[model samples]
Target chain A: MNKPPTIVIIDYGCGNLFSIQRALTELDVPSTISRNPDEIAKADKIILPGVGAFGKGMENIRRFGLLEVLGAFVASGRPVLGICLGMQLLMRASHEFGYHEGLHWIPGQVTKLRPGQPGEETVKIPHVGWSPVNFNSNNDGLFHRLQNGTYMYFLHSYFVTTENPMCGIATTTYGNNVFCSACCKENIVGVQFHPEISGPSGLRLLQNFVFLK
Target chain B: MKNRRIIARLDIKGPNLVKGIQFDGNRALGLSEDFAYLYYQEGADEMIFYDTVASLYRRNNLIEFVTAVSKHIFVPLTVSGGIRNVEDVQKILRAGADKVAINTAAIANTSLIKISAEAFGSQCVLAGIEAKRKENGDYEAWVDYGREPTGVNVVEWAQRVVDFGAGEILLTSIDREGTGNGYDLELTARVAQSVPVPVIASGGAGRKSHVLDVIHEGRADAVAVASMFHYYYAKPLQRMYSSTNADGLRLGAQIDEGNLEFLNARYGGILERRFDPISVKGLKSFLAGSGIQCRNM
Candidate 1:
């Protein structure tokens, strides 16, 4: 059989590295977790998974000299998936813990979800829990096999607002705030929810990412 | 409205999944990982594994199970118990746990919450509050598996932890825990109302209505169930595993741990008269039927 496509899970010392790897393993796909730019350069697909503040995430990405390599990887037209904070890192800039510039892989700003108005059903921050994501008309296969309004687990305080409305592939509502939960531009895709732990729907989403050509 | 969460809380004693009434006399139901996977499959929004004995032992023994369980189930996992410092939090999160719930050390120092939040992020830190109602009708915070009192008012402590950078609160009612009586809604509402972040009401969930009541009345953003969910499967799983002699099907079925002695009197280690088992899926549908939003299967 042809060798399975090489999938690289970028390790910037910022997120849970094993959960996604284990999910891929369950899918019968072998992947590598590396921060080395050389290994990242040779991958068929690359996943940027992060779980922290945007400033700190960018600091680590630059410290490891991954900015140029990641930019080039995106430029190569290979499929790229960014999960949670990793998705926020793909935007032009983030206002989390002071303004920090991102890879600009997609033009967007990562901003905190506005607090719900008083006496109007308070909207919790960190948006913790399982919320439904409504898919747009975009035909990106990342959400293939997943229905609109399918509940996915989300645990982030900030969300991405893309400059181009078409970039938003899926949107989730937490209180009155309906922000872009998933975005795509060219070969790059980003999701605010952690699909690795999102049950069957989540597993299916990852399977869809892997099946993408 | 945002969907409220239904979390499956697995209380671990040694390597076994245990449940106790009023925070004492725990009986082992089965292996921890088995039940965690079962809950995940049943549509649990999240999972929290609390090491019941970790505080006394001064070390969390849940790393192995966290690593094993996280590999199979694709949901956010929270680990609590004996997480005294930032390093402990880092170790648990690195082992694939998405969040860490702290109680004993946070009460002792309070800075652990702020420091861990800064070191990691606010979303990574959860303040575990064990509250017991006093005679004056006020709730006080307890730690070390509800064995010691901190003389701190529960509602005040909830806000304090949030101010200290805790992203969420895991509020357990020691008075209602494992009692099948239901949650302490008054206490849950007091703390939940005071905090801006999400409050997960835990410890007592005897039936479907009790789960509904906590969300509606107590204002809890999430509800964590242990006995109501676990007991539903304990007797059936015991009979199936024992009949097939599938000891290996479980992680460590033969281990003499937890309140196995209490379970020895019964045939399958469960007291059928005490509480009825409710499936996580059943509770979700019931909640949805009652107009409360939950993640649909």
Candidate 2:
């Protein structure tokens, strides 16, 4: 028999930890919400859930000294997931609330979703509510059990832009074109949408993340 | 030309459906599942379930209820009550609620609105305000199930909610509730004018005309009435439901006249549909833009 995955949700003082913990618990995954580095180090997988400005979130993680621990965990080839602002933190830097440095797990910058050029209806910033997210890669565990064009809820102002297209696993559209919704590179996965609040679709996504081998 | 919306609001007490007067007069009515299906078949565009007892209880029952309802219903559903922080909102939405409404939390933290809105999106984050007319004729914000006053001016607080990223405002009036005297149009208008996002008028709605009046005159994007529809004393119900044959009413009214025409035209089948102003307006706009000639009646 295989043991369930031990998932540690990083409680960086700016996340919806309990709810994410509860969702993981419902999926039968063993998860804990903690700010301590030891608990995160001992886990099979880690989740960074955040819900605030980029600078403040990174500041809290740095203040708590969980940054090195999380970086070490990611380097260990184990699964690490960053949600919402947590995903943004994986980028090189963010322009939100003034410029600030991120974890730089992914090679990119976090920029706002602005309107299109002349004669174009620019998609508004903070694309909210249930929008359809389509997978770009078919060989990943994130999109394994899910069908194409699945609608997931998203609420964010800024998005990550990576030089490497291989990092993007799924993309969703708002006004005109598509933007990266989920990105994966090796054991590290980042999602801009809250799989916890995305209903059954979100639950299935989380379940996929938990059981990813 | 935006689409009209059909919304169903489920008032819950624990696991069962509850109906009462205002915020204090709640009584368990029946299973929420049954009513949910009923409203879905009736052509509700979207559904919202408020856990009136959520703040009172230690745990939120809205998640389980939303899960059950999501299995059977395909429309968008929003759940609210007792959400104190971002974590609470996350749990409800992950459990199958498309949106989470926060009332008391917004009054307490104020920042919770921005956090949830940024993390979840403004559309999924709603700010529900329970207001009562003060002695000076101005509506004041209330908290703790409408028993405590926040001392914030209702209009000012509304602007703040929007600024904080509340995609929509759920405004409920305590004074005119259950009285069916019609909505506090003045208050609703003030709130609608104050916020840039959509405002859902709650509290006092006695007749179908009141719903129309609030949406058209009060400038509310949506209206929520619990007791009027639950108790069955809701007048002009049929007029709003199947009055498609009336001439003076707008083309939007005809589309909502009955579920048959609406379903045959909209849903591709015959289903009993309750007409919501949002959905009706959308249908009208669609027809008008498409050049489909149809009279108001």
Candidate 3:
């Protein structure tokens, strides 16, 4: 029998790590949550799941000393998935409370969804609840079997804008703001939505990631 | 416009799913996780697991429950009741809850709203406001699961929590809850208009049209229902629990405790003429047919 692939969910004291681990368990796939560089290096796939502030996320990742480990993992051309703030961390920088740096794996800058103008105050800040993602027909990377315009749960004040158009795989609209909800560049994949908590369609997206070559 | 969220609010006491009239006299329904998974499959936009007696006990004990539910049910989960400090908020979030709703603590120390929002982004903080209509045709904020009345005005408090960094307001009407009359549309409209953050109109939803009225007339961004969905699944869930059904097996694996007495009695011991069962899928389709946007079934 062929050996089962090893999946590692990076744990840096942010985001819901159990849900991601349990989602894979529901799929009958075994995985582990760790910040250990050796374990992460040996894994066939790594999922970077996170929630909370951008500066805190980057700080926690560095505090765990996963910077060089992650950099080497990305450089190895293996599958690396970043979720929510994890996706934001893959960008060049974020302008949340203050300007903060990111991994720059995918060239982009994370900024507030709506910068709050006079009439724009009507547009809600956190952008909570459900919004549909319009998949890029040309490159439907992780969203392979999922239908176009699939509604996914979103809860973040800031969003990512990839410098390269090819990196943008899906777009979602909230009020007047139309931003990228899912993106990928080469071997790196990231989604702004929490697939672990997003139901069956979300499970399918995770399955796609689990089997990616 | 973004899809209007239809959240399944489960009032939990001890380890069982429960429903109450005006936040009083809670009747155990079944297992909370069973109903939560059913709602998720039915295309409910989100789920709220409010520990009904957490405040009275002076601690939020739903961390284990939150961890178990977040595993199988893939949807946004909000844990409410007895969130006293930033550490409590951190613990719940760490347990896999997407958001934490604060009511009694925030009313006592409003700075909790600001500090938690700063500690964890505003998106993770929810301001839970339980409102009761006064004789003077105004509303007052009530805490301790609607037991004690605070002098704070509901409308003004709604705006203040948003300024204090609450991302959303869960507005529950004490006068109309579990009465099946409908939402307090006037109160809902007032808070929805005052706060820029999303206002989730909760309580007193006995029918499908009541949800429509709240969104259109009440101007609420989302609507949460407990009795309507729980009562509908009570009997069927009981049957599956007895048998070795696949869903039952899945539910059994996650939850080790539940109250099956209400299920065994078959709606006989409770108040007579309770609401007829309403499926979450049926409610969403009904809302969609009425031109209201919701996640597709």
Q: Give the Cα error of residue A122 in candidate 2, in Å.
A: 6.7
DockQ for all candidate structures vs. native: 0.74, 0.06, 0.53
| Tens digits of lDDT, candidate 1, A1-213 | 756789999999887778899889988888999999999999999999998888989999999999999989999899999999999999999998888999888999998997778777667787888888899864658877788888898988899999999999899988889899999998998999988888899888988888788
Q: Name the runs in model 2 displaced over 4 angstroms.
A: A115-125, B1-8, B13-15, B20-27, B31-126, B130-157, B163-168, B172-297
lDDT of 1 by residue, B115-175 (tens): 9998887887999999999999999999999999999999889999999999999999999
Identify the leading candidate in terms of lDDT.
1
**In model 2, what lDDT does residue B72 have?**
52
Docking quality of model 2: it rates as incorrect
Q: Write the residue-wise lDDT of candidate 3 on A64-87 in tens digits.
A: 999999999999999999999999
Per-model fnat list: 0.85, 0.00, 0.69
What is the DockQ ranking, best to worst? Answer: 1, 3, 2
Candidate 1 whole-model C-alpha lDDT, 0 to 1: 0.86
lDDT tens digits by residue: candidate 2, B1-297: 122233556777655555545666554434567667665554454678988777766457777777666655554577878899889888887677767888887888989999988776676788888899888988899986677888889999999898898888888888766556677898999998776666778876655566767766787666675544443322223354344444321222223223334323432211123322223333334444554221121
- Best candidate (score: DockQ): 1
Q: Once all C-alphas are superposed, what RMSD does model 2 give against the true structure?
A: 10.3
TM-scores, chain A, per candidate: 0.97, 0.94, 0.95
